[model samples]
Target: MKDIFTCDLRTNSKLPLGGKTIVFGGDFRQILPVIPNGSRQEIVNASLCSSYIWSNCKVLTLTKNMRLSVLASNIQETTTFAKWILDIEGKVGSLNDRETTIDIPDDILIVDSTDPIGLLIEFVYPSIVENAKNPIYFQERAILAPKNEVVQEINERLLKLFPGAQQEYLSSDSLSQADFVHDNIDETLYSPDILNGLRPSGMPIHKLVLKVGVPVMLLRNIDQKSGLCNGTRLRVIALGKRVRKAEIISGSNIGNRTFIPRMSLTPSDKRIPFIFQRRQFPLAVCFAMTINKSQGQSLSKVGLFFRQPVFTHGQLYVALSRVKSKDGLKILIFDKDGKLTNKTSNVVFKEVFGNL
Candidate 1:
């Protein structure tokens, strides 16, 4: 599909629609794209890019969030409306007292995201696979990390994960190899295809995952009740088009990213995109609570694995929000298990997150 196939959104005014089908998404409040020479103006949004063109596209607004409960979702939708017109700063992720004082359960999945591209694929490729039955063909619908080394690792891992998976490893400079082309890492000027994309060395795994439409899992911080330490899985979404210095965590690097596979959210590679956005860890366990990744989609079947539930409010709310009704929720903890009496110690954290 010729995505940027010059529809000539160039109109009477830039925002004046040139026969457009711009299914625009993403928040203008978040990260901005990193253009060469790094001008703040370069990060400007399409909302501002050519309001004229956008002003003309056939309008269709999905004000309703499918994931949140009728009440929470409605409240949020109303808030979005208020924010849309009033420009309220109501979107606050500022840390609170609960964040610092809260103590969560141990055994949180701890991961170190070193391989940027592989981590991106761990999250992105799955969703892409879900939507694009054969991704190699939909070359225009994807983004590639700049680092060739990271890209190489990703290709190897993808093949390892799905032997016949169709994908193209690309780079800017003319080369037919799968390795880091640091010299051409900033080659975003060219369009992405199965064959062309570049990335920098030591890219941040988080950004890479987000760029490729995958969520990220960072051990936000350790909250422990006993002798164990735990991590948080916060799936983030960039508020803008693209940026530089991406951070990613490759699951193929098992020795690096630490995950308690039995307690993490591991959506199959083919089922990720429908998740909207989530903390795409290399591996996820059967019954752990997931993140806001469920924001835009709906699920018929979901399994929730939770126990002492000592984590951030986001973790709790996100986990609870995964299922549509009480029947879709399942608990995977053993309160009667020995040495776990204190495991329930993370109740406050769980309660706050659960209520949200």
Candidate 2:
């Protein structure tokens, strides 16, 4: 009764004029709007899923895949249709312009959203500096997930094996307020100087980058021109504010420490909606987001998603190809007959394929 009757409907017909995303989903051939079964001739429609609407996208076809035998055709139809929907992204090249890429030296940092961030410390600066390829190096490895609980567990286990390893994290309340950038959520970062001697939040995340003691960038989450909607692919980019003092949402008349030195400002533009006026932070350069962050993004390498629930090979291909070339790409998951091919372990295969 929910998805069929009382679900939130987002369509060109249902939305207010000038809405950014027209998320229209329905098999017009079978379902009718409002008056059910009272249709004359139904249509198969997703007209709004057009190149003019979205940014970076790739066309993919999961149907007629010879990877499956004739026996699975009937059951596979729905999955294929879903894949078709995911693959029909029109004119997505413009979307790639959103992500602001920060080119920090590789040795300076290695970012991981998974558990056991301490494992990174062990992997890079071992007690005796050995090659990373040794199997003994991976003996304490565990799957990396974004949840704090999971990461804490991995860190705890790793501590027992490697007593010297230190777990690192940025426990900032301001930057970590929202749990997701998904769905229809409007988000903005404000750096107001309302309180004397007060600083905007995002200190922890700032410290995360500062501890590295290297030049870095910051990225914004919202795309002003494109407009942000639920799952509308919003991202913020930053260049040198990674470890700077940011007084975001200030109550006083002061800007973040990064405001003057890092982000060169004309004073007025630094107010709200920094996109309007001409302002550029020297220590920072930011773009929106690319196809890579949809699944998620990493600093250097990534395990591309190409499994069943993830559409077709095209999405995986785009995700994998986001790097300079194949050198930074690795297949993390794959599907065989809609099941994961590598189930025993989720160790992301690292490869410097000399492509990206």
Question: In order, what lDDT does every prediction score?
Answer: 0.29, 0.27
Per-residue CA lDDT of model 1 for 1-356, tens digit only, reads: 33332446345333223445456664332222323343333334322333434434444445543443433435654454333321211123433323333222232211223543343343334444454223232211121222234233443454344423232221222321232243444334332342222222111122232223222333322223321122222222222222211122222221122222212232223421221112222211101112332332233233332323423223333333333433333322324442222122111111111111
Candidate 2 has its poorest 10 consecutive residues by lDDT at 347-356
Model 2 misplacement above 4 A: 1-210, 214-315, 334-356
TM accuracy, model 1: 0.25
Go through the candidates in order and give the clash count of each.
36, 51
Cα-based lDDT at residue 82, candidate 1: 34
For model 1, the superposed segments whose C-alpha errors exceed 4 Å read 1-12, 16-297, 306-316, 331-356
lDDT of 1: 0.29
